[model samples]
Target: MKKTLSLVAILAAGTSQAAGFQVDTHSARATGAGGAATAWLEDSSSIYYNVANMVGVKKLDITLGDTGILPSITFQRPNMEAEGQRTTLSPPPHLFVVYKPFEKAAFGVGVFTPYGARSRWEEGFSGRFRGYESSLATYYINPSFAYELHPRFRFGAGLDIARATIELTRGLDFVNSEGSVHLGGADWGSGFNIGVQAKLLDNLDMGLHYRSAIDIAFQGQADFQNIPVEFQSRLTDQKAHADVVLPSTVTAGLAYRPLNNLLLAFDASWVDWSTFSELAIRFENPSIDNPLPKRWRAKWKYSLGGEYGVTDALQVRLGFTYDPSPSPNNTLTPDLPDANRFKVSVGAGYQFKPFRADLGYQFVALADKESTAPGMPGTYSGNAHVLGLTLGFNLQ
Candidate 1:
């Protein structure tokens, strides 16, 4: 039982879906203009976007910011259906510091909601057979430093001290009983992050970053109340154990400004979902047909955004992104409810001396995807929509 719960949490795929466990945490000033801040990062937000850029400074700098993700989901199929619904507010906030304690070098530290998110469904959703209710959350604090080998080459590294929690529930076998069974519990782990940025030419810049995967091996207790009395008594151990393998990923991209005040950026990233197979747990031995038999494949996602300086203090940004699904239809699980997605975003920012404000909006359309397990009766279709907001400020 413990193993099953742990698998559910580690395998809870959608926890950070902008890219597996990635939400692009940064200042709205950066995101407001579609991450064009790569080369133009003359602000304190550089602590997260690109620490090396802090070399632009001559004074002490500080930044504080926050963003929100509001997602809506829906389920449909020949045999089952549910109304579209929106998730609760996922508020992510960040703080950054850059101290030019010495010339040609910058020292910094920050606390932010770097990676994590969760989803929830009503008790009677159609895909209950695969997963009923799901919940996950994570927080990170990083103490970092960076140096400028020269005006064009900058590098940075940091340790990610993270805390996470997971909760899961799935429908029980009707032939077996009533209501859904809780299949997961909360657990925590830690990891690291390393990244670099380069200015090869006057108008071109590149960035590379890597995030290590964290394994949440959880231990807990569980029991099945709906099962027949005989089976319940025989399974009295109640101890649960599971090893959840999340994957490490890499991202590389470029930023270019075509016109005097127009900036362009493109980023391509890889997420290794292949690490997930059948989320197995052990009793005396592993169950042949664990309610969820998932096989997610590795995939890549890319984004292109542009920023235009409307005026010295205000700028407008717009962009589009396409992401392929990691899970095949046959292996999809309600817990992950993932699909290929298309997103469109627009935002603007205004800077007034030492203060700045950013506002943005986005719309996401999900492809119609399905999931069907052999013993799980029928197939189900899935879909969803999402909108987000970002706000930021920097001061000396």
Candidate 2:
């Protein structure tokens, strides 16, 4: 069981749908606006969006937020009347704090889960050869600083310390038998983020942000359970090692306020998922080393969102987003099933004295995808619900 869990983690890390499972929903306000915050951020959560905007924050502020992802994934194969498999949900949480003791300089610290999710398939499912169960998670601890270059422009940078964990389980080829392998590991890596924000006009602002890629080397032990008598000795109690790269991304956005009580924002983002070209696992036994191909390509996403001030202390929000898949048909497996998708969201915010709170919800629908891979023929469909909450407090 231990080995099955560990192996599942490494393999599952390679299969993600949201910008390659990068987790774009960080702040409830930004999520409610369909992830268009770049220049429209006002709370300390700006630490995760555009670091340059940190200088625009008011006094000292801190925010705590969480996003829950509930996904329903199903698969159907040729000539099979059996029911589809369903997946489990994973939650991502975040915390951020920002302070500006000087007129032109600001600093912040944050802890957040930027990438993670899990998938599980039914026993004896048609796609058992590809994957049975897996889970992957990543967390980042960031320390950031920003400077107001001028009255209208700001620049910022941050250091990212990241930690990742994985567990995976999959079936093995055996005659009329139930045999599986488990793998698990954990590691830490480093990366960086940079951004620039400018007030283009009195009521218009523009921003650009970039997050660098992180490489992690996961080392752990693998266990072969219920293996046939012939394969048991060679596969059990072996050491495992895998090197993986988390992709990089760039985003640009604009925020415009035509009326004092209304704000609009739009964003375009590009992710370089080609970095995740393959997954190679090396065992203590050199003869067992193998590589898994992952020919993912770069992809783009667009979002638009709006907020209206309904009263002095209340605001309403709405947003929409379009995300295209990067995985190709030939390499598409049940483990990492994916396709183009759309997201619609709604949220509201209210302020009570020195504290402000916001809640947002999003509905995700993925386009159906079919595969004709030689012996593996199947169709995958999925939908998800995302809910986010953010709480902010002003100390100064």
Candidate 3:
């Protein structure tokens, strides 16, 4: 029972909590700085970022977007310390649709990868001494509706269905004469999202959206070969039944045209990271230690960003955000090296009448976190770079 509870807390929050953990400035207008404006989602993207903004559309617009994320990590466990890391490539894509079927009613739909990333420590990597590899993938399908009530008033709603899978390999410190085992599992879940956007005034806009929490139950088994005994409690063990929680959040933004061609936007948001404070999974086939410790806590995230139009055909954006690590300093694990961060981003777009294209780039510099946990060890002093592109076509 102690082992099961311990294992659950070790992997829950970092793996399942939905605390806006990603610093994705995917929109050209949102990335230029770091997504400071929530009101700009008026475009087709309102489906993922803000459904209330869906009413900001005047015609039928469809958008296709993609972003590539590359990150590096380091570790300083109670014993040894390693630094400066490089990870493989993970690409995420998005698609959005908005149409004013009638004058007062608008329909929207979008497909995108909301929260995701991949972390792989190559063979011989230092962390391998503890447990060495992890990768996660996830996506969502969003369908929504919006209606314009008055000249500057609009209302909207959204529905989201998400799916995910993962492949991982961790090292097990051995004690006795037992070989270490490799552990892994895959699961899926479903959930819903609701939102509202209203023009607080002519130059100020307000938006709020929430994604209901979900539970993904893993069903796959694992393969264990050369394992270690000391770390066998966590690594060599296999889980037949386990469940993870995906929380929810709310976002708000404003857009103001400070100049004739210059549009300024800023956004503020919050997430429910506390739902993951802990987790305990009871395997259908109970093991010695069935329920483990999924110790995670509530976290908070906020962002500020804006966009400017250089000309009728070109526009630029910039944003910044602060993300707090939900994993406490005491229980920090290698499966997820999460911590607070200060993000900087830049992006631009080109508009051609009914055709528009956007591109954005971001850099994440870690805020110093010198945590010397027991199992995982490392001084994480690295950064991450992200590239995003979006294309939009209006079916007028």
Candidate 4:
């Protein structure tokens, strides 16, 4: 119970977004294909999707990409007029490099943004007491190795080094007046990822991948403002500590090529979000703890995509995905209002000798949800757009 509360305090605001703030837009190829590239290895960037597929890459390759995510949310109370909308745009970069020094072995490195979120609400809003400004960010660096065990089977493993940071602000009331409290923290953690790829038939490929969870303990200071003079001593800048576990994931996928120039793929993944049940922040001054509740559940996501070679130098891609939210209704807050999402994606790629460039765009439609959580009461609706571009070079 004690550990659970600490975990909740550190991760509740971080993981309350779409599928608990787990961003999957790692590569343009994957993004264009609705993140269904697990079993379809087309470029060196597959190191992050399925490292085992590296056994099929024969040259030194490097890819650089970035994703622009724009999100909007609107809220409405029963009788009051609709509130103004909140919008924010986030851009994260990705890089991957692969080298094959032997016929049966390969090595690769990847730097990607797997999770992040930001939310800001106007002051004096209806839900101001719930939260005002919040943000969470993470970066991962992975070094992986792959080996071909047989003509049709390959295995891979990698170690992940990640750094994360978080900031949260909320309104508080004292003596019939309004005030605010702010908290900030950062940490570094380690984990591992593993994968396997197999050719089930002459034209069918299958893959399985898993990433272990990383645990981070955060230590920082809590700052308060506008508090009455009486409680200033105990509410001012104080030391705080909390901990959270970044959940793991398991993915399975299959790719089939029915023609020489056309390929189709599908993937399904399960995320462990139940680890976050409660969150507690311990303060140094009064030695008191503030615990928040978040009964999140596991979530599943599904994606399908197809690629067609228009000519020797160009390829067209189309994809779709269904992503469900894991946020429990009782814990829903204004700072992280999220719902199920349906996404559509399209992209194209051009290859010129050793250089290739790819571009993709995804549109997300979020379902409207009604929440009657203790302090916050409203209906929330939102949408998102994601744009990605990747440039790669082949150095053989």
Candidate 5:
């Protein structure tokens, strides 16, 4: 029973749609710019990237956006190869509103998906016992306020209310017979974020933002099927609980305008993945209690993006990012075959009076990873295509 229940740890340590499963597609403008708009205060998305920038809002601004992610992954071992079977698109949405009631103060709210991922493997795959299908979704609702302290400096803080859901399916080993187990759960958590934005020079701006970690207590059920009659009594369905701590992050960015028509931005982020060193699960049946070690390490991500005004109402953008995986090779598993990633993106935006629209596309490529973890030994390779669209309106 312990062996069979060990696989459940993957539910909390699953594959990430983005770097370690953190989603950065809050706005099409930022996405097209490779997510480097931390200091480029041009849209309401500032409520997510750097709330301090909200002080720049002239009056009232609202932005709505969505991103679709399509992934293709493959795993190979010796003479056998299996293709990931997930075919559906994962779409995460974002909405932000900023209102400036006075010259020095602004209020804003944002709703977005900051972390989520989905993975599916073909039937009869060698790693089915590890994890066949899994999905995780997290939502963050933030309400923030910003104030201009100095003429060129602004500071802000926000409260983060988060909700998360998880579901997973894995095959159960019975030697000669095949069985399966499914787990599902939901939980709520809270955290906080603070940011500072400063205008260093007429053409340069700097911003720093920090988000605290959140702890979620999940309570759910585990259902088992096809258990042999001999072991049915021991492996029956039961309740389960787990404690998971989401990582915190600190990001710094600079936006520079070298040319009157061109704006360039760069950002660096440090993720405290070390906080997820282990996961402890307590089942209704004490016999199945499990503690899994993750040993994930902290990592850094870098992004560079540029936008050029093609005309008074049209703009073109391009961006690039390098994100390293936090999961170490020793503990890597089939459920989340994490690896370093490189991304390239391009987009365009148009402004029409009180309405604006932006479209962006990005391609993510993961470096092939060779894993020798216990029963699953293979080389995993994958890539994803992401497309995003955003619409904005200004009410004065």
Candidate 6:
């Protein structure tokens, strides 16, 4: 029973791997530019990257988009190898609306998925005892307000409302064969975000954005199945609860335009993942409570992107990003295998009067990592392909 409860803790803790689960493809324009749209302006997605930049929108703007992520992950140990199945086609969609009520103030709302993950391993994999199937999804709704504090500066803040769901399934060693345990839960959380944008020079702009951490309390049930009649009474189904903290992040960016037809942008971000050092799960049966330790570290991410205007209504963009993993080897788990990654992206956009359409594609390559964590020791390798599309309409 203790071991079964421990798997629950691992599932909850593993879901917070921002480096592996974070969804950065909020906008096709930004995704194509390697998610480097902090200071650059021209779209309603500003409500997400840097709300202060909402001042760049016209009288009224509406943007809608979605990104499809397909990931391939594999694990190997000695002579045995296993592949993770493709679980989802698209996690969620993004929608942003910005309205300028007056010349100096702008109000906007953004709906998007910031964190999500889904993975499934083969039926007879060696690590099935730890975890074989897992999924986590979070949705965020932000209503923001921006004000022009100065002719060249603007500031904004938003209220963040989030909802999250988690599910995990793993096998239980019962001496002869294996029984399975499935746990599912859902919860709600709240946080805040703030940002500032400034025109530093005639052709240069700078922006900074911050998103606060959110604590969620999940309550659900755990179900055990296929257990032997002898142990069925001891491993009965019961309710479970866990509290998790989503990390905070800060990003700073700069955009430079050297020519009328070219725009370049760079962004750096810091994630405070150290908050997830430990986790505790309380069950309906107090005797089976379990506590787990996960000493994750903070990480930094950097990106660079450029866009060139090819014609009056056409633009092309290219971008690159370097993201490092925060999870140390000692705490790594099979549920979420993470590693440093490099991402390259390309995109194009065309405008026809009040309507604009953008298409972006990104390829993620994860560096192979060897893990020697306690009982599970193996080599993990994976990569992902992401495609995004966004449409914008200027109502004014």
All models, RMSD in angstroms: 3.8, 3.5, 4.0, 2.2, 2.9, 3.1
In angstroms, give how far residue 380 of model 6 lies from its true place: 1.4
Model 6 C-alpha lDDT per residue in residues 310-366, reported as the tens digit of each score: 998999999999988777877676765777778999999999979999999988887
TM-score between model 6 and native: 0.94
- Across 47-89, the per-residue lDDT of candidate 1 in tens digits comes to 5565556666666777776677766666555454553433655
Off by over 4 Å in 6: 1-18
CA lDDT for candidate 1: 0.61
| lDDT (10s digit) by residue, model 4, range 1-396 | 325425223333322224568888878877888889888774677767888887777778889999888877777878877664456677878999989999999899999877777777655777766667777777899999999999899999999998888787878777578888888888899999999999999899999989888887887778899988877877878878777788889999999999989989999999887777765677886444656677778899999998899999999999999988777777766656677888899999999979999998998887877877786777777788889999989877
For each of the candidates, give the backbone clash count: 6, 16, 45, 5, 1, 0
Worst 10 residues of 3 by lDDT: 1-10
Q: Rate the local accuracy (lDDT) of all candidates.
A: 0.61, 0.80, 0.62, 0.79, 0.83, 0.79
Error of 2 at 220 (Å): 1.6
Q: Write the per-residue lDDT of candidate 5 for residues 1-396, one digit (tens) a residue.
A: 111122224653334557777888889988899999888755689988999999888899999989998877777775775656556578999999999999999999999988887778777867787678887888999999999999889999999999988898989889999999888998899999999999999999999999998887878899999999998888889998777777799999999999999999999999887766654557788886656556778899999999999999999999999999887776677766677888999999999969999999999998887777666677777888999999999876
Residue 60 lDDT, candidate 1, scale 0-100: 70
Per-candidate TM equals 0.84, 0.94, 0.86, 0.94, 0.95, 0.94
Quote the lDDT for 380 in model 1. 30
lDDT digits (tens) for residues 1-396 of candidate 3: 112222223332232112224434445555665766556666888777777677778779888877777766565544554644445666777888898878888898878766665555555565554345555555677788887778676777777777756555555445454343344566567777777667676676666677676666666455566755444465444555555565566776666766666666666666655655444434434553333233556555677776677887987777776766666666555555666666777888898878988888877776556555664545554566778888888766
Clashing pairs in 6: none
Better of 1 and 3 by TM-score: 3
